[model samples]
Target: MEKQRNVLQVNGLNVAVKSAQGMLPLVQNLQFELKPGKILGLVGESGSGKTITSMALLQLLNQKTMNVEGSIQLHGRELNGLKEKEMRGIRGKDIGFIMQNPMNAFTPVYTIGNQFVETIRIHTKLSKKQAIDLAIASLEKMNLQEPSKIMKMYPFQLSGGMLQRVMIAISMCLRPSVVIADEPTTALDVTTQLQVLRELDRLRTECGTAILLISHDLGVISELADEVAVMQKGRIVEKADVYRLFDHPQHDYTKKLLQARPVLSVNEELSKLVI
Candidate 1:
């Protein structure tokens, strides 16, 4: 079998913001490759530039305020300096995004089904009837109950968790080759968080989505990431396989992060007893 091409690659990426306050560097010398169906978790605290790195890949950061350098290639093609119209096509057609807050993304004016159908029509060459059917099917895939009712309700009418399910459904409908999930499940409580994250993992397994998952939660990273990139003050201090990073963290900062995270998993439970 032929080796699969990488879905996304970033090399020596630098992102900086300019303001009256001064030029503040966000991300520097960041490099990573995301293969098809694998998830690389960008783990860091706030102000560490995890979200800035994600924005740089698609050129989504405000051009007037932020300047970015280095190569961000998708499937062997360089994305740097791509026109906005070109990037728009790639944003949803080839790469999907699940934002941190569903409310921030979900339009309150449109019914869920209408918005979903619109998304399907925009990304896919499908008739209105076909789009509606596809939208409903996507909702079902998210394991949502009363899918029909959800399809008809507006964003404000649904709960946070329900709205999140709708957002996930929208992102997964076309099975974009790359998915950028930026703190997607952080708004939920523990039980709902598990449900959402597990569903995200399931989607990756089924759809071959190469994910750039951003989250400060180590427990969440342990559950979903194949690889981990530890970020601090705009740079990745360590990048390693998940198991190795957890078992033998080479950097002091990485080890401190691991130590700070509360023990939550069965593996950690066993380790506690062994210790």
Candidate 2:
């Protein structure tokens, strides 16, 4: 079989913000790629520049106050300087966003059905009824019982877990070639988080969707990432396969992160945590 090329390429990336005092670098010299049917984990704690990287790739930045330098190529096309109108076409249709908090991206005034239909209509040639049917079907795949009721309900009516699934469904409705899932499971309960991850795994396998999975949770990365990139202080400190990264981390930060994961069994936990 012929090898598929990179769907997203980021190189020489730098992001900085301007304040009253001076310039502050948020992400420095970051570089990576995502091929079809693979997941690249962007792992780091809060304010470590993980979210900034994704926004940079999609050209979603406040250009007036920020200084961004880099090349972000999606399907062989550069995205660095595209106009907002030009970027809009690609944002949802070619590249989907599963935000850390789904509610942050959702509108309080609209029903789930309204938002879903609007999203579908933006990227595809679909009528109101067509989009509505697709939305209901997508909700069903999330294992939501009485999916129709959820569709009629407003954003405030649903739990965080439910909203997360809705965001996933909305993002994938266009079958985007790449999905930027930023802390997608952060707000969910443990069991719900597992379910969401499993659903994402299924989506990746079944549809060959390229994923940029960003989170502070190493356990989440261990469960889904094909390759891991460890970030610290706005730069990638080390990167390796999940198992190798866990067993033999090169950087002190990476090593410290591994040490923080709780052991599963009580005996193992006791042994590892012995005073």
Candidate 3:
């Protein structure tokens, strides 16, 4: 088999916040690589620094009070010290992000189509009509019905699942090299969750987009991630291929996480756990 190239690499990543006491470390000495067309699952409990890590990669953290140290390389370009303008060009173009809350990703007042066209126009030189066409095409890729109709509806008028799918469509419309999906399926029903997961998998297969998927659900990780990193207390204790991580987890926290879920038969596929 051919080796896949690394689209994103993080080395010696540490995130700290200033408080009255002193600097409080949220993520410590994190290191990982995201390969093209593969999903890397970052699994951890709440407050384990999964979200902060992703934010740091995008340089989305506030520089005023937060201290981020180490290297974040996208396509071998260092991004830690880039200016906000430079980072803006990288974001949505080279690196797309899907936030945990779909509603928070968009302006409540704007129609979904308007936002989509604006986003595409910002990243590309496409005209308004061309951008709208692309947006509708991308939404159709998510299996969303009446893509044109979805564009006219305001965020509040759409269901949570619909909004989540639209968020994915927007993030992917640019066909970014790396996509940071932070809990993309959180708060959604089982069917919606499955649809979202399938869309993510399709992105990997169809577009060869590397995905850094952060989720608390082991089942979700098992279904989508090629490799899994088990994090606890802001540190990754174990890292392995998805099958190895599930069948032979090395860390106690990983073991406990598996035990916390319902029992599965030895012969069952990891995807079966989702249903």
Candidate 4:
């Protein structure tokens, strides 16, 4: 059988922002590929360009003050330099994004049901009723309680974990080819973090959705990622399978990061997360 093609491909990606000093690079020559049903964890400390890379892929960076160069392809379609109208069509349908702050994903003025239903109708031909049904079902699949009641609530009414899962439900309902989860579990408690991670894992296993999992947490990376890419100072310093990267990291930065965390905790969490 022929090998399956990658679901998402990023190559030679560079992002720079304007400054008094001149163009300051936020991400430099970043490159990675994500196959269907696979999670490629992008791990780095704060200011390591992980979030910038995601913004570039989603074409969300402000062009007025920033420059994003090189290829960001989904299902072999070039996304760089596309018009905003064109990108809008692709953003939720072809690729989904889950941000660290669930509140950012939602508008305060809108009820959860309104945003969820509207998002569904935007990318698909589903009617309002159908969209509501799908939205509720998706939330239920995430193990959320009282999906209907939750939908009636506004963004402010839900807890952080509930809001995050609702966001995941919205992202996964469309079954996008890839999902970019940027620091998704950062604000959640340990139990909520595991719940979110498990939902993401389910997205891959059940729906074949590729995921770009970006977090500074190695334990989280070890739990979900099939492969890991270590980023430092706006560049990828190392990329490897999860086990290998943790067991015998080659990069000095990677080594230092691992040494900084407790091995037993990571391993215990990894065991719980791995199916």
- The 10-residue segment of model 3 with minimum total lDDT is 264-273
Candidate 3 lDDT by residue in tens digits, 143-177? 99999999999999999999999999999999999
Off by over 4 Å in 1: 264-275
Residue 178, model 4, lDDT: 95
TM-score of each: 0.93, 0.94, 0.94, 0.95
- Clash-forming residue pairs, model 3: none
The CA lDDT at 70 in model 2 is 87
Candidate 2, 1-275: lDDT as tens digits: 98889999999999999998899899999989997889999997788899999999888889988889989999999999988998999998999999998899899999998998899998889888898999999999989889889989999999999999999999887888999999999979998898899889988898899999999888889889999999998999998887888778899999888888877798977898888
- Given candidate 3, what's the lDDT at residue 157? 91
TM-score of 1: 0.93
lDDT scores of the candidates, listed in order = 0.89, 0.90, 0.94, 0.94
lDDT per residue, candidate 4, 174-206, as tens digits? 999999999999989999999999999988999
Better of 2 and 4 by lDDT: 4
Q: What is the lDDT of residue 27 in candidate 4?
A: 93
